[model samples]
Target: MINIEWKQPELILLDQTKLPTDIHYIRCTDWRQVAEAIKMLRVRGAPAIGVAAGYGLILAATEATQSNHPFSEQLSQFYEFAEELKETRPTAINLAWAVDRVLTLVKASISDNAITNGEALINLITKEAEEIHREDIALNHAMAKAGATLFEGQSNIRMLTHCNAGALATGGLGTALGVIRELHANGQLERVYADETRPLLQGARLTALELHEDGIPVTLQTDNMAAYAMQQGLIDAIIVGADRITTKGDVANKIGTYGLAVLAKHHNIPFYVAAPYSTFDFTLQDGKDIPIEMRMAEEVWNFHGIQTAPSDIGILNPAFDVTPHELVTAIITEQGVLKPDYEASIAELQSKVQK
Candidate 1:
């Protein structure tokens, strides 16, 4: 196993929007700046966003103390800031989870009266931020092991994946891509087929880059090629990550995921969703309840400042699409591999963890 450390502080992030060329990292200081960076996708990926959100709260708390704000005032400001940060991206539940955790930490510090110095409050929040990062790394390992079981005894697997679901998406390994990585590490993987994932092209850019760098066998194909690949027996399984999984086991992921699920159904291949438990949303009963984030039309009309379509043409680009639980063969989380009966399995897992 390779020991992975967080990127250098100076290299904050490699601006995913400008990949393949112009690899640049933007430096950040203070929490609001980090939140803005995250909103702009200067720093992104589900796990990375969560990690950054933790740091953002720390930065806000530190700034409040420096300004000599009263504890009551700081608390009010912190909640408002946290809410704003949570709204930056709607699909990824980890962003909200991270912010809420940090808010709890801030509240505890103020109520505990264990630290008399205001500076100590800042230090405490920073510690929690680091813990969030550390915990994510541990969770990734657990999720990978549990998810890998889906491929057990299945050799020469030709797995097809969508978007950037590898280490770039999670803390260290990944969700869907992590299982593929585990298979490759064990020499069970034959090849990984990546969907170009239109518009954003996370698969062609990030997924392709990470797999190639790790010496994993991979090929990039357009979103439409998935069905053809499966038809030709080029795909043995379909593995992908999720932005959110409802209580009913319906999954909301990259915009094209629903289509892929339909294709998987026709091909009679097993479709698996790999994600941490944090991605689960018990509040949503089914896919219909998951909020679909509609992005700006400029994303579709413009390609890197070049006009891809006419300015007068209207476009509706949704950040994510939902896949019904019926289309999913299994849902992999740190707790274990769950069948489509998520309501029962998730409730069971939550009860155990809460205990």
Candidate 2:
């Protein structure tokens, strides 16, 4: 379930757009191709996108190094690749976080004169990219463990989730879904309800597929049915993955996630957001500052080239929406779950990391 694979000078991505039926891989030999895959949703999910972007930088550096360009020129090309990859998806903070991390490492290496040769620079970049990938996997596992603790002493926990945050979405198990997997492993999970996320249907096509393959009991419901499901007491809790979590604990996730959080609040169901620390955007004080990506109108008006709505009609297709901090019961990360007073809690966790 490795969605993004780096085989040195080449990157392979699972074609997410054609899932649940056709399994295909898109091979990218250059950074531009990787950027295109991100834009086209070939490699999606916040963590997955970040991992892909890291490898994309490696491809760019490899190409520049193979050209025998000056170290400064190669460095310039790395920045260019970073800019292009960063622009692929606006909602996911992990994309920028990962790119900046690798770029900063390269800059530090140059400043310290630790990388004098092109090959050495390429090797360093590749190693860093691999580290990002490996760390994402480990973080997902840690997040699973931390999140599962919330369900301690509870059995047959029925969880509802939005979008697809499974192995296909990360380098390892997943985020929110990883928690569900842990619950299932412990025999504490009763069933999982997946929302058929509109326009893309990642939950229906990807999430359901992943859970089914893993032999986890799952039920598929349309996005609008969540409220009814909650009313029926079919849902014990709501857990989802985040694209961006601001310093104040506000979250931006798939477009329907905000609505789900609202419903969870009204229904008195706990809402949890699971993600790696990289998904946190410390600079953004609130979710309002997190930019939302608006996708093409055809995604709503048309399905697989078949018109579902009148052509030329107005459509507002935002790829993500923000949920206020108060609506979130907890924010689960690899470190641990952060409770209320999130500004202080998040800062404390980040400081621990810095130390």
Candidate 3:
């Protein structure tokens, strides 16, 4: 279940697009190949994408090193490669965050003359990428512990989730799914109601697959069924993973997440978001400023390459949507579960990370 793997000079990614039906792997030896994989959804999820981008930079450095070109030329080429990787996906802040972190390290290495040759730079970048991968796993475990506390003294808690935020979606255990795993491990989880997220069905195809393989009880339902399930008292809580979180604690996640949050609030069910600190985009004042990625209409008009609608029909396929902070009962991170007065809480969490 290793979604993204870095084996020395190459990156191996599980082909997420062919999950449940076909198990396949895509090997990336070049940075452009890595970029294409991200664009094609061969490897996705916010944290996973960031980890892939870090390895992509390492691959770029490897190519630059082998060229035997002038140091200035190599550096310029690597920066261009970084920009290319950045453009692969705009909505997931983790992609840009991971790329920038590696770029920053590269620049610092050059300034201090710590990496004079391309070989040395490649080594340094690779180490950083590995560290990013390792830290994600640690963060996931910490977040799971913090999130599990919310269900203390409550047994057999039934939860609802959107999209595929599991081990396949990250470098570690997962974000939202990690919380679910922790609860299951503690014998507090009864079952999971997974939304068959449309246009892609990541929940049905990925989340359910992952949960089933792990022997976790899962019941898949169409996205529209979420509210009805809530009304029926089938769901005790709603937990989702975020691609981006604004300073005010507004969340940008899978497209149907906003609706789920609204339903949760109306039903008096707690709505929670789980993510690492890197998912936070503090520079943005709120969700309004966070960019939303619009995917191709073909994704909606066709199902597994079979036409589901008239080819000429108009379609809007936004990959994500924002949920206002008021609807979120808490935000779970490696630090702890952040409660309201989010602006202050977020700032406090960010400052601690800085220290």
Candidate 4:
């Protein structure tokens, strides 16, 4: 079964925090539930979060349909709810794009007598949301193949990755981790050194589990162990997935990605970011314009309600960090690999998709 799917109460999402040991599902029927899930990382990944928001719209529409509301009234209410959902997480463009896509579809589909059959609208909304999920999975596969070719002629490539950018992170397959999967399938992968991302441990909790389940050889290490591993000549390349990319080619990913980018530059190892074109934000000229989300401070001070640090101490938890364009060797997208002048290349890809 897919991790997130449309079901009765609303949308069914696999709680990612409870993965590897327990598979739990949270049924959400409203935008508040969707916002909470995104904020808590219960439903995560750039692509997956977007999909969740799209489904959230459908769920909200179901309520409107049941109330026997007119199509215009229902759509206005749903659009407002989707806008609120979009603001819950600022780092992922997929969330904004997905919500906007659904609203736009609703506006175009409605007419003077659109409410003639609310049931039909619900079915169409469900179909569009499913398409979002299906398309993301297909994109992951195509990008993985294109990215794996960049590591050609290099046998036994020892890779180091941070956070959970695997099938769990995307609708299916992954972004940067998808390339790692492709390499393993082609017999070029030797080992994967996964960083146990602190505060949340997404790497240890999610990435490691996904890779292990896939029968890939993976080792989990603390975030501090990355530079040490590179210095020991144990790493060949560094790969990561992005939450957002600016027109200037700056990247924003998990909090620890900036440090890894610096270490890769020092070690003279190539660092690559793999993502779909939806990740690129041509509106932002540089990383400075990208808003970094300051998460709840309690995440750093406690784990599952047990205090790990002094209770009164203050903690600043930024969900993501920016990686300079210079540190990234290249970016792998579904269309193909793109270079630093990502502004033009991203525009070209968007143009093609639009046509």
Off by over 4 Å in 3: none
lDDT (Cα, tens digit) per residue for candidate 4, span 1-355: 3678877557888998787678899988776887899889998889889888878877767767676677667666766767788898998888988887777776666654544556776776788888998899999999999999898887898999999888888897999889999999999999999999998999998999988988899999999999889999999999999999887789999999999999999889999999987788867878978899998888899887788998688788999999989888989989999886767776777787667
lDDT of 2 at 230: 100
lDDT of 1 by residue, 109-217 (tens): 6689755555776677677778888887787888888877877787898999998877777667888888888888888899999999988788997889889989998
Model 2: per-residue lDDT, tens digit, 74-143?
7787678678778889999889988999989988988999998778877888899899999999999999
Q: What value does the lDDT take at residue 31 in candidate 4?
A: 61
Runs with alpha carbons beyond 4 Å of true place in candidate 2: none
Best by lDDT: 3
lDDT by residue for model 3 (149-203), tens: 9999999899999999899889999999999999999999999999999989999
Please provide TM-scores, in order, for all candidate models, with all chains considered together: 0.93, 0.98, 0.99, 0.95
RMSD of 3: 0.8
| lDDT (Cα, 0-100) at 244 in candidate 2 | 93
- In model 1, where is the ten-residue run with the lowest total lDDT? 2-11
* lDDT of every model, 2 decimals: 0.79, 0.91, 0.93, 0.86
The runs of at least 3 residues in candidate 4 whose Cα sits more than 4 Å from the true structure, single-residue gaps closed, are: 111-117
Over the full model, what C-alpha lDDT does candidate 3 score relative to the true structure? 0.93
